[model samples]
Target chain A: MSKKWLSLISMVLAIGMVAVLAVGCGGPAKTDSTEIKIGGDFEITGGVANFGKSTVNGIQLAFKEVNAKGGILGKKIVLVLADNKSEPSEAANAITKLITQDKVVTVLGPVASSNVLAASQIAIDNKIPLLTATATASKVTVGDDGKVKDYIFRACFIDPFQGEVMANFAAKSLKVKTAAIYVDNASDYSKGLAQVFEEKFIKNGGQIVAREAFLAKDTDFKSALTKMKASNPDVIFIPAYYQEVGLIVKQARELGMNTPMIGTDGWDSPKVVEIAGAAALNNTFFSNHYSPEDKDPHVTSFVEAYKKEYGQVPDALAALGYDAALMLIDAIKRANSAEPAKIKDALAQTKNLQVSTGILTLDASHNPVKSAVVIELKDGKQTFKEKINP
Target chain B: MDSSSFLMQFAQQLINGVSLGSIYALIALGYTMVYGTIKLINFAHGDVYMVGAYIGFFATTVLGLGFLPALLLAMVGAGILGMFIERAAYRPLRNAPKIAVLITAIGVSLFLEYGSMLLVTPQPRTFPAVLSSTPIHIGGLIINSQQVLILGVSLFLMVVLTYVVNYTKLGKAMRAVSFDTDTARLMGIDVDKVISYTFAVGSALAAAAGVLVGVYYNSIDPLMGIMPGLKAFVAAVLGGIGVIPGAMLGGVLMGVIEALVSGFISSTFRDAAAFGILIIILLFKPAGLLGKNIREKV
Candidate 1:
């Protein structure tokens, strides 16, 4: 009797889990015949909440457009969104809620790759197709054995390509002979990009002069920056998020080591210029999913419509979110069924899908084989420099 | 590269370490003071520092105050908030179980963190450059004005604290109250007033550290208080809980050791190295470096 609370809580948890599993095992819960449900588990309120919010907005925009032109496959697209609060555990919980409680046919988002990796298994086990908008981690779709997971897919290019694109650009275009790397070893995204870039740069005949590491919480970079200055690398690669990347760029610039810096999509936030100051942002570039400066009509009109809807131009995250939802809808239409398996197969064969970023085509690994854009910063403005095709 | 270059690098790291160490010392002082006075961990003290930084942030960015003035405003704001927290939250749980009071302190901490997050989103704000941070090079050694300012302001605050705790009449009363609260009250000393003064002084020091960090790092956020707060507590314990100089020594040592580890070894194990040293120090000197063994009267 004294252990009643413990037993009761556990029993409730067990029952809830069973109920979820039952729903997963059963075929789709019959809702309105004219409605097809899709779930969104977004990181809408934590460190990467910006990505989540943008993703949700992007999905909403695509859904609204589809609804206006007669819903996909003769069914109204019902998006059931859940905020994961930018936590991994919450992302998993959101997916479970969607599959069991909402009975969604497929899911989208939980943008950051870490969250994607965390929530991927549940969707895999429960047989729900989960499509990520911008998660670039190679391991997100491809298993540790280097095989593609059946149900998990990403709307963006993988990390190797992103790192390769930047390294190639720096070597072949910018003609930088040497580079320094400052990475956040605590973050998988940063570490992944750093390792890939280092490998590819050396392959491209560029020498790594100095390599230093820091944590996400570390505010001081002078020690690392000072050492990097001694080597005098032609370029510095800080493949970290805006929080640390902005500071690194500013400090590096202030230290008079204004070697042109390159970063990944993590640096594609307005906070970068704000933290680093506009003057310090000069001569810095980053590889991203979409460049608003792209003259592509899809990108231009998406920016305009996104501005009208959200009161701001969509960032790389927003563009990817819209693209992911658009493709998912396209898959549903191509499959011509409400079944999850058919949709997954259709998603595998998606080709020449015109989205905001570029023409998206899903490779065998479930990652889009799309071109990546390198945007140059001028007075803190993102200018389209060149697009690297796969 | 060369010996002189190595020496220059060593000196530069030493400066960076000491500059960083001073802020830890400042934040650690608050923890030491609160624990010394009430035997409470005062988990919310770091949040008071966060409050101070935000105060300084608004003062500089919104009110258009200069660096010194903004710092003063931050100190005043945080000092008052510290007193208010002690009166409202901690005071209510004072007569409760020790665990209750400790839990309340943690609650206060989370409330401050999440409340601030709600008020000013979770986005990290760029702290305005109250002082120019352009590195001033000397020989091969590099020093920035912000580093100099951190070292200078921290030393000034520590010195002022040492003076206040050692010489002022309020200092005598605070010491008396901290030694034996019941006895101090029985002897006609204002116990409540002394504790309030202790919280104010301690909070002001933490606030100063907050502003200093905002300037040094050029970034501040609501959740910023958590890590530094825990680290300061560690510094307080490593120095010898309830001892002023012990906290200072512990903080400086921790900062120096961390700087050296990250600079020479690997920054990935920076936190592990810090906690690892703390474990070693505790194993050797259980009462901290400057902590003295006091016989239990009971």
Candidate 2:
């Protein structure tokens, strides 16, 4: 009787272990319910942490609003966020983990153009849809055939458009017949903008009197500024991030080079004022996505909600992030499924979507066709000057 | 090419290079002096320079002090930091292997750099422009007041250091300690005091360099000192490590070479040319330009 009882107990224990093992090894149990999982890789902690954190907050708010409105296709959308540390290799790894580990169908972010370029290849290989929020490099979407890829989309206009807008403004409005460009040789974004701006300005009968280059981390612009001053340009074009831009402007002014300066979207940072004082930035201008003074209801609502959520006014980066999330949700709803191919098709067909920035229509290259706002610096504050549709 | 035009450009480039070279020499003095006495490379020396920049930034921006006062306070604050770093990190490893000390130095460097990043924003800040905005014209070439100030201060410091090392009693004790710590200690000199003083002096020079460069460039960042520090180290090595005047000579030579290469060849190859010169110099003169050959006791 004792032996029979022990055998039965042993058999029960063995069966329980097998059940646990089976559940553990068979992957997550898929509920027969409605839920769509999306992932995001952002540089939440690095040199550009402030921008990344704001972008993440914008995305999360969009997801929350969508879920409150009864999520896409009657399914609640879930977002899984990961930090990429602003490194290209880490961005790729984070995206890989998102797709393989989290089982997310669509991914968003990795904000900087360089990181987006590095990580998008993984999405391409895995056949997952990636909608970048703020990366504006023209090459982000165009392939060897000069066509948009099936898997990648961006919510921002490319660098060429931004470059042309600034060049046109400098030539026509500023009425500068000669200009000099000081570009960050190490940055692809800066190089691209400088190339396009030079090409367009020269074509418009503006002579590039000087073309000087410096490294990204260099702080000293005296020598470069001195060289530029010798060329006697009326205006200078600096297409780099705000950190370097601030120093360059201050150094240029300090060296007695009083040339008016213009820049691209990279100049939209509060740190610019903090670094280069208001005195140095008095006559600066730049091309940006949208101005806070824009009277569009969508933009105003986004501004209010963003201020309420973040306790600060949202910049172009935050607005682009919100728009990217909204557009992705809209695509998911139109496709009615989270399959990569279907979402890509829906994104390719995106049109007339009134985002916070403007009514964005996805061009053939998966870039947005929208208006670029020109902002001028007065007393270290950015004020809306004009808006040009390209 | 006409000799006059070539001479004019060459003179201008030389002045620009020397101004930059003086800043490098000021920072290199810190590295070479510390290595001269301790036989350990303080990798955190660069971060010390970075901290000095921040100190000046805060002193001016937040504390609202005058330029001279801010510079003095920055030097003092950086000196204290150097003392603390030596006490906490290097004091306990006084008897450790040279490699261990080197590793600790690197670790301290990373700690200071990342710590600064966490404390302050990683974005570069534009240093306030207070120096003379006027460019002094010499014939066809022009030089700024900041460059003149940097060159004057660096030369003054080098001369003062040379005087101290050759004449002062404390300087004699330092030299004695560097030559043979045991013998110096046996002869009634406090070796620890000498080493600490060495660090204090080195850190003071680095702080001055940091502040000067900040004013010169009109920008400061947490990671600004790494490349400059490395280049200065290379300059020290090129001039003969542990030799005071050699460091200054090496820095000026390196600077002029870099400027010439960028002006003549390409800016892309400037760094390569500087290092290539170092390699060639080291190949011929292993003891450096001013280094002495000392036989190992073992």
Candidate 3:
């Protein structure tokens, strides 16, 4: 009798474990005709939470604005968000879940290029449209062989354009003779921008005085900064993320090497000032998208509304997220169907799509042909300098 | 690039190394003291340092204390926490096997890291400027004010620690217990109290190091302690695990070497250089730099 009871309990336990497993991975897809589903998997936690949070905020705002005006094709939009927890593997899982379980018509986000590269594979495999607004690496849309992937699309100009914009600004606008390059050696994004900046700066008849490399988590750049000081370049180009940029800037000033600094859009976050302090923010410029200081009606209205809603000025991440959402919703409307393939075709033929960033037009490579803005930092406030046209 | 500048850069790197090593030395003191008294590695010692930084962060940000006061409070709070951990985790495992106690230490380490992450979230916080960061220049040598604080505080703590270990009654009791726990118990000395005091002293020192590091680096996260903790342990081992002065010596040397490698060579080889020192040291001196060999009869 005891042996039979033990067998019965084991059988029940096995079934219960399987049921629990099913609940986690097998969130069944539900199809609804009345509302279109849009999925977003963004890093809401972990190291880069600041970036992801802003992106999610922007996406949420766009969806709210669209819904208030009646969502595409007279059907309400059901926005689904999954937190990637700032990890690539988690991003992969979130994207897969959004596609297979949530059955989102077209997915948007996983903001970093590395993450987009990881999460977009599932969308490509399943033939669903995946769009990114901020992932600047050309590889986000283009394959290893230089062919554009059909399903992958980006609203931001590729890394080459960002590097070229900043290099041009340095040469023509600021008119610096020589520059130094310090890049985050671990990031492909940083390396790509650094490479393009080096090439373009030299092409514009400027010389690179010195080049140094450091990893992402490194706190001490004094030795590298000292080397750069020896070269005595007029401007220092740091194509790195905000977390490292603030420290680098602070350390650079402390080391008595007060070369004017230029960085990429990765320096767009407000936390850079918090990290670097206000004193170090002086005499710095960065290339970015859609400055909130723009006088354009669409830009001002969106910025004002976002400020009213979020209680803070929207950063570049927010602008990108809003644009991606707006464009995706527009594609769904243009397609006039909730079908994934129809939406993909519409996105591929995107033209004159007015986004929060600017008037965006996708080339065959899926990168937007939009202008990049150079912003100068003064007293921790971003002052719009001039826009560089592609 | 040139000869004179190279020499200046070398000197600057040395200064940087000394500042960095002092922070390591501060944490290593706790390891040596705890190991000396209890004969346990106390792997959670690093997390105690991490917790100390968070406490300092709150003290400055929430309570609005000055730098020195926040440092003191953090040290005291961590001391209490270290004793609490001892009574809770280590005390129960006293009579257990040595391996069991070691595993428990590892378990406690994980618990503190993950628990802190869950409570505080795994986001990196900018440590507020406890001290100003104006560079103090002397003959092309740029010294950050925070680095000066680290060197000063570590020196003060080390001197006080030396006095306590050499002159205090509690220090005598600690040495007695370290020499022989069973005999110290028979001699009417409270072994448990001495052990707890050792933990308090060590943990307090580690806490002080944590606050100094946060001020120096301007960033702190839950998992930040893991690498530094392992590095401190290696430093402790290098200087002779239970030897107080040895840990300090080991820490300073490690820092100098790390700075040299990163400054003269590539920053890519910085971590590799640290572990490489450990391998070479272990090969030549298994008992450590200051450790003496004693044969045991079977």
Candidate 4:
């Protein structure tokens, strides 16, 4: 009976393979004249689903507008989305499927820095240009040997830039003499930002009174906060995602260690206010890619369109997603072809392209030399404070 | 650091540890009680705690119940779930190999975790503030109202548990069943009913711990039970697997050790410290701190 079942299963598999081959041979080529397919590898379902969902929304909106304007290069841009499920291994699988199976010309996203780093090598091997809107880790575009991955690029500024911006903001704007560094050990993004912030803060003539590390998903931070409180730094730099950040802030405030706290773009989610109460998040600041409150015509128009479409203000991830998609579209238009290698060259040479964020130009590292905005949280509202240009 | 500052930090972390340990102790009770009777570790105990938190979340948010009512409702809901799980999953495996029952428990655990994740998307929900977390300072030591509530509720439950076990007729029957199920049945005590009651009581305690943790942490997720559950199981083992008071003591000690390790050594090693202690204890005292070694009859 077992042998008979095995034979039946093998026969079914043989028939399925034949059907797939027949369809492959008979069907039109995967990419046709009507649409130009780009791949979207995003965290559609796991821990950072909100980031992925927002990014996809921004990408969809950008493509919608571009397609309505008689398409890019006279062919409508079609985004083939694959969910990474917020796992790095799954991210590699998503990108591989997008490139090998779907055969997209360009791939965008997998928003988290770690996810981008995991999937970047695949794009490099496949010679397909991969652009990420919100992955700010320096390693996303550069290798360990300090060489840029030609096929990899990001629309947002690198971690060191944002870290330096915050370090400068704390030392100069906030006039902080001593600061503590609370880093998430589990995240490449958090560690990169924390490392840079430490160096730049000390370079800016400030002392790091305390440095502590925590794994992500740790709910209780009181013990660490108490330990850090003994040093009593003027400000605490927590370069972690909003989930842990909200808990840290709430626990810190509850513990009566209410020093000013600063963070990076990971704190941009509205969930931060929900997890950490509105009152607890007061006096906290985070560096972000773009602020919707910006008076720039490009930002206002993009913000208005995003609000009209999604019925909410676009966060930094959404803005970067839109910018990344627009930048890719711009590169494609400049190259005047849908070829991946040409698009990579055009992307590497990106110069002074006006987008929702600001005047975006690719640096030597394939990172955008754009400005970072400092957003101050007051009673759960993100009030724009200052914009620092690199 | 100066002696005064070091001492102050030590005291603060101690309070924090006890508060955390109380939650562990509450979950540990469920493990201890269920294991005491049936000798089967309910791996799904932690997920039951997670379900309880969600029940408390909905009770507070949807039904607009206050803290006490929501907590009570969560306990009742989880208690029923515990009984249902025991009846459906464990009862069939009563005469089966112990390994089979253990495997079923783990299967039930996974089912609850992913099933809840599917029901409530993997997104972490912010549990509404059921109690004011106003900090009360006593010298350099600061304690929040929520911490006080956790300690109060945990202590109250432990006292009630002690009384019921020592004085009540049902508790005597439960004790009898744990000692020898065949003898208890021969003595006309319905063994099945006692087992069901044990599960109900254990699950209710876990639910209470869940609600309290939600109040303390302010964030609840479907997978929240995995870590705390394992830690509570360790606490039960460290205290003496089937010993009630031992579970409490082990839990508080575990919490304090975790707090001190994170405070003095490093936060990254806190989890390592917990399992490390468990290994050391198991190596030295195979029967646990309070467990007595009884040679099995030939």
Task: Give the interface-residue alpha carbon RMSD of model 4.
Answer: 1.9
Q: Candidate 2: what lDDT?
A: 0.84
Chain A TM-score values for every predicted structure, listed in order = 0.85, 0.82, 0.83, 0.82
Which CAPRI level is candidate 1? acceptable
Off by over 4 Å in 2: A1-130, A137-147, A175-179, A205-209, A294-312, A325-346, A351-359, B1-12, B61-64, B80-104, B118-145, B178-188, B263-265, B287-298
Ordered list by DockQ, greatest first: 4, 3, 1, 2
Candidate 1 matches the true fold with a TM-score of 0.81
True contacts kept of 3: 0.35
Per-candidate count of clashing residue pairs (backbone under 3 Å): 0, 0, 0, 0
TM-score of 3: 0.83
lDDT of 2 by residue, B1-298 (tens): 3223757656766876788788878888888888888898899998899999889888888888866787788889898898889889998999999999999999999999999998997867766665555678767676777789889888988898898888999899989988888899999999988888888888888888898888777678889989888878888888888888888998887777776666555555667777787788789886678888788666
What C-alpha RMSD separates each model from the true structure? 6.9, 7.3, 5.9, 5.3
Q: Rate the local accuracy (lDDT) of all candidates.
A: 0.86, 0.84, 0.87, 0.92
Query: What TM-score does chain B alone reach in each candidate, compared with the true chain B?
Result: 0.96, 0.96, 0.96, 0.98
lDDT of 3 at A24: 55
Question: What share of the reference contacts survives in each candidate?
Answer: 0.38, 0.19, 0.35, 0.73
User: Could you give candidate 3's per-residue lDDT for residues B88-197 as a string of tens digits?
Assistant: 99999899998999999999999999999999888778888878877887877888887888899999999999999989999999999987899999999999999999
Model 1 over residues A203-282: C-alpha lDDT tens digits? 99999998899888667786677666766789998888999988888777766677899988888788898888888999
lDDT for position B21 in model 1: 83
Q: Between prediction 3 and prediction 4, which has the larger TM-score? A: 4
Model 4 per-residue lDDT tens digits across residues A67-153:
999998889998988899999999999999888888899999989988999999999999999999888777888899999899999
- Clashing pairs for model 3 are none
Model 2 misses residue B84 by how many Å?
4.8
